[model samples]
Target: MIDITIEKNLKVYQGKQILKINRQFLSGSITKIYGPSGAGKTTFLKIIAGLISPEKGKIVIDDITWLNTDAGINLSPQKRMPGFVFQDYALFPNMTVLQHLEYATGDKDWINRLLLLGKLDTLTDHKPTHLSGGQQQRLAILRALAIKPKLILMDEPFSALDPEMKAELIGGLKVVFKGLGATVLIVSHNPIELEGLVDGELYIAG
Candidate 1:
């Protein structure tokens, strides 16, 4: 289980805003997060991933403390090691699809399986510049899965995919997530996009 209570100051066009959240995420659950445009959904994920530090917060996962502002303890991103799929896809300009997964894990078998799951097996040699927008997004998802992380944070992961592709990928990801027993939190703008995939929902108001 993951427990979090965080407070951060956000900069908005009008003025400063505080983003505060106190929540718990059950183990192995898939959660869909949605809210207004500047509601700090992505910031919430980033804070949990250790990419952004909150002004004050405490985060504990499975009895392990990841962050405790009162104690002046904050784990580094590498130590936290959650699989993060950035909104931009964040693919390497020079690395091919195969290389991306290889960088994350040495197991060729697992890499091949991820490629197949993402439907990028045939495009293994293609670089980010060569892949289409949807393919790039798939590569980002596959790269995150390559590490077999316990916690996966995805920011607008399915925005570029077509409906058919999104549905198929979601089905495959369900099996993979279950097999790994990974807790996933996805930030999405579209409410209905993840209808059947998410086991829980979180709404953050700006």
Candidate 2:
């Protein structure tokens, strides 16, 4: 299980936003996190990934302390390498599609499987600039999976794909997640996209 209870003061355009999260995520589960803008949804994910720090709180995963403010125990991002797919689809402008996966792992067979899953086998040599927006987004997803992480966090991952492609990819990802037994947390505004795909939901009020 993953337990998180944190508080942070976010400097937004309007004013200081107090972001507080208290949640428990089960292992090998799918959770959909939704909320209004400026609710610190992205910040919450960052905190979980150890990319950001909260003024006070603790994060414990399977009895292992990932973060404990009082104890001064905070694991680095590299130590808690959860697969993260950013909302903007942060892809390398220089690396080719194949290179992205190669950078994550040297498992050529796994890379080939991911390429087939993302339908990027033909575009393996293409750079981010040469690919379309949907393709770039797919590459980001593929790269995240190349590491075969136990915890996957995605922000608006399907926003760029068409309905058909999104549906297909979700189906394929279900199998992958099941195979890896990875718990997934996806932040999306549109719940319709994840309808029957998610087993749990976490709503944040902005």
Candidate 3:
């Protein structure tokens, strides 16, 4: 399980807001996180990834201590290594579709399998600039999966994809996450889009 309890001060539209959360995230489960725009949903994810430091809290992932303010124990992001699919699709401009996954892992068969899952097998040579928005998003997801991370975090990841693309991609990704027993936490404005796909739900309100 991934356990977290933190209090972070965020400067939102209304001014200083304390985003506090104390929760336990089940391992190998697909969870949907949603809330108001300034409710600090993204900030919560960032805290889990060690991108932002909270005022006080402890984070434990499967018996491992990722964070403990009292003990002065805090793991770096690289050590946590939770696969993240950013809202902006943070892809390397100079890398091709294939190169992105290759950069994460050299397992040829795994790379090929991920390409087919994301329907990018035919565009391995294409760069981020060459692919469409949906394709780029898929590449970001594939790159995250290439490492077989134990935990995956996505921030508004499906915003650019059409209904068909979202459905197809989510369907394929469900299998992959289950296969790897990876825990997934996704932040989406449209929670209804997930419907039956998610195993749990977390709502954060302002």
Candidate 4:
């Protein structure tokens, strides 16, 4: 299980806001995180992934301390190594589709599987700039999975894909996630975007 109790200050148009969260996430579960704009939803995920530091909080994953601000303990993102899918895709501009996965892992079989899952098997040589918006988004998701990470954080990961494509990709991801026993947190503005896919929900108040 993953336990988190964190507080961070957010600068909004109104003023500074405190983003507080105290929750426990079960192992190998998928959770959907949604809230009003400027609610610091993305920041919440970043904090958990160790990409952002909280003013005060402690995070424990399966008895392991990932963060403890009071004790001045904070793990680097590389040490934590949670797969992250940024809203902007965050793909390497200079790398080809295959290179992205290759950067994460040397497992050729796994790379091929991810490419097929994202439906980018035919575009392995294509760079991010050469691919369409939806394709880029899919590649981002695939690259995240390439490492077979145990913790995955996705921010608006499916925003660029059509409903049909999104549905298909999610279906394939279900299998991959189960195989990897991953715990996933997805941030989306559309509440119903992950309707039946996620097993839990977290609504962060702005």
Instruction: State the C-alpha lDDT per candidate.
Output: 0.95, 0.92, 0.91, 0.93
Q: lDDT score, residue 119, model 3?
A: 92
- Sort by lDDT, top down from the best: 1, 4, 2, 3
Q: Please, what are the lDDT tens digits per residue for candidate 4 over residues 108-167?
A: 999999999999999999999999999999999999888888899999999999999999
Q: How many steric clashes does model 3 contain?
A: 0
lDDT (Cα, tens digit) per residue for candidate 2, span 82-181: 8999888889888999999999999999999999999999998999999988999999999999999988989889989999999999999999999999
Clashes of each: 0, 0, 0, 0
* Span of 10 residues, lowest total lDDT, candidate 2: 12-21
- Total backbone clashes of model 4? 0
Error of 4 at 119 (Å): 0.5
Each prediction's RMSD to truth: 0.7, 0.9, 1.1, 0.8
Task: Give candidate 1's root-mean-square deviation (CA, Å).
Answer: 0.7
Query: Could you give the candidate ranking by TM-score, starting with the highest?
Result: 1, 4, 2, 3
Which residue pairs collide, candidate 3?
Answer: none
TM-score of each: 0.98, 0.98, 0.97, 0.98
lDDT of 3 at 22: 84
Clashing pairs in 2: none
Winner on lDDT (2 vs 3): 2
- What would the per-residue lDDT of candidate 3 be over residues 140-190, giving only the tens digit for each residue? 999989989999999988888899988888888888999999999999999
